[model samples]
Target: MTVHLQQEQQTMLWTLAMHAHDAASTRPILGDRYAADLLDRVDDPPRLGLSLAGNTPLICARAKLIDDAARAFLARHDEAVVLHLGCGLDSRLLRLDPGPGIRWFDVDQDPVIELRRELYGEREGATSVAASVTDPGWWAQVPDDVPRLVLAEGLLMYLDPEGVHTAVTHALTPGSTLVADTVAPWVTWIAGLQPAMRAADTGFLSSTNDLAAAAGAVNLEDELSLVDATATRTGGLTSTAIRLFALASGGRDAMVLRTYRRP
Candidate 1:
C-alpha cells in the first residue's frame, strides 16, 4: 500500500522492522508470528538496508523485553486496560491476547491507523484510536476505574521533555503502570548521525537520565537497556565486545526500558 505518513510518523517503520526481524529470525527473541503475517500484508519492503541493518538486534531486543513485561502484567491483571502508544504497525495485541475482559487500545495518528486498519481488520476487545498520543484528549475516551498498562515502546525519545511528562504523568491514572524506553543523551546525539533516522527527518528530542519529572505518584520498578540485551543476542567477538562496552559504560548512559508504577 502507498501510505502517506508524515515524516515523523514514518518512524513506525523501525518498529515494523523489529517485528519482521523477530518473525524471520531463526531463534526469534519475540517469536511474533503475527508480525510477519501483518508485514506480508503491509506492502513495504521487509529487508533492512545497511543504514538500518545494525538496528535489528537493538530494536528486537527492546521489543522482547517489552513483550516479557506485558505478558507478566497481563498475567497479574487479566482484565486490565492496555494502551499501545504510538502503536505503529505492531502486532502486539495478537501476540499478547489478553482475557475477554481486557480492553486494549492501539493508538497512533490518522494515516498510520488507516494503514493498520487496512492490514489488520477489527477485533473483539482491541480498539484503534486515530490521534496523536501527545494529546490528552484520548484519555477521556478510556474508562478510568480499572488498572491500566501503558506500553510506549520506542516512543519517548521522539517526544520533547514536556511531552514525556504529559504522556507519562497526565495520560495515566493512579494504579496504572507504564513501560517505555528512552535513549540517554549520548544515544540521542548518536541517533542524529543515523542515516535512516535522518532520512525519515526524525531524531531523538528527549534525553533525560530520569523519567521522573512528572512521575508524581510513580516509582521506578526496573531499569533495562540496550547493552543489557545486546550481548545476550550476539555471539563470539561481537558478544564479548558488547558485554565489555556495557560493563564500562554502565546502565544509566544507554538506551533503556524503564517500568514505572503509579500509586
Candidate 2:
C-alpha cells in the first residue's frame, strides 16, 4: 500500500517502536504480548524498509509503559474504553486482550485507518475511526458512560504545543486517564544526530523540556516517570543507548512517561 512520504514515515516509526517493545518483552518483568505482535509485523513488506537503529529499544520501553498503564486501567474499571489516538497500524487490541465487554477505538487519519481496516480490522470489541486527533467531532463517537483510557504513543511530538493541549482538554472525562510518551526539548534539538531517523518526516515539531507542564496547560494532572528499558531487554536499544544519546547531545533526560488525570 503506497502512502504519502510523511505518512509512510509515521508508519515506519510506529512499526519500529513496536519491534522494540517485542524485544524488551523477552525480559520476565515486561512480558508483553503487544510487543511480540509488533515484532511479527516488522517483516511485512508494506511496513518494512525503514531504518530503526538505536531508537528501536527506546520505542519498546515506551510501549511497555503504555502496556503497564493500560493494565492499571483495566484492573480498576470493569467496563472501560480504550482510545488509541494516532493508532497507526498497531495490533494492541489483539495483544492487550481487553476482553469481550471492553470497547476499543483505534483512531487515525482516514488513510491509515483504511490500511488498518484491511489488515487487522475484523477483531471483536474493536473499531477503527478515520479522523485526525485534532478534530473535536471524533470525541462524540466515544461513549460518555464508560471510563476512558487514552493512549497517545509517539503522537504528541508531531503536534504543536497548543494542539497537544487541545487534544487532551477535549478527551478528558472525570475518570479518564492518559498515558503518553514525549521527548524532552534537548532530545528534540539533537534529533538530527540520528540521520536515519530524519526520514520519519515528523513535521519538525516538539514541546518544552517538561511534559508535565504541557499536560498542566490543559488542566490535566501530570506525573513524570522514566521507563527503565535496561531492566527489561527485549532489544533494539537499551537505557544505556538512551543515556548515551543524552550524553552525546549534552542532555539531562531523553524520554519521559507521562500520566494525566482530571481533577
Give me the overall lDDT of model 2. Answer: 0.65
Model 1 weakest 10-residue run by lDDT: 208-217
lDDT of 2 by residue, 1-263 (tens): 45443633365445644464445644533344454544454453333333454345556566666887798788888798899998886656766788766899998888777767765647888888888888898888798788888998888877777777778776666767788777777667666554444555444357544345556644544544343453345334555554555455434345677777764
What TM-score against the true fold does each predicted structure earn? 0.93, 0.78
- Clash pairs of candidate 2? 20-60, 21-60, 23-234, 23-235, 24-234, 57-237
Residue 133 shift from truth in candidate 1, angstroms: 1.1
Clash pairs detected, candidate 1: none
Runs off by more than 4 Å, candidate 1: 44-47, 250-252
Which sections of candidate 2 miss by over 4 Å?
A: 1-9, 12-51, 208-214, 217-227, 230-252
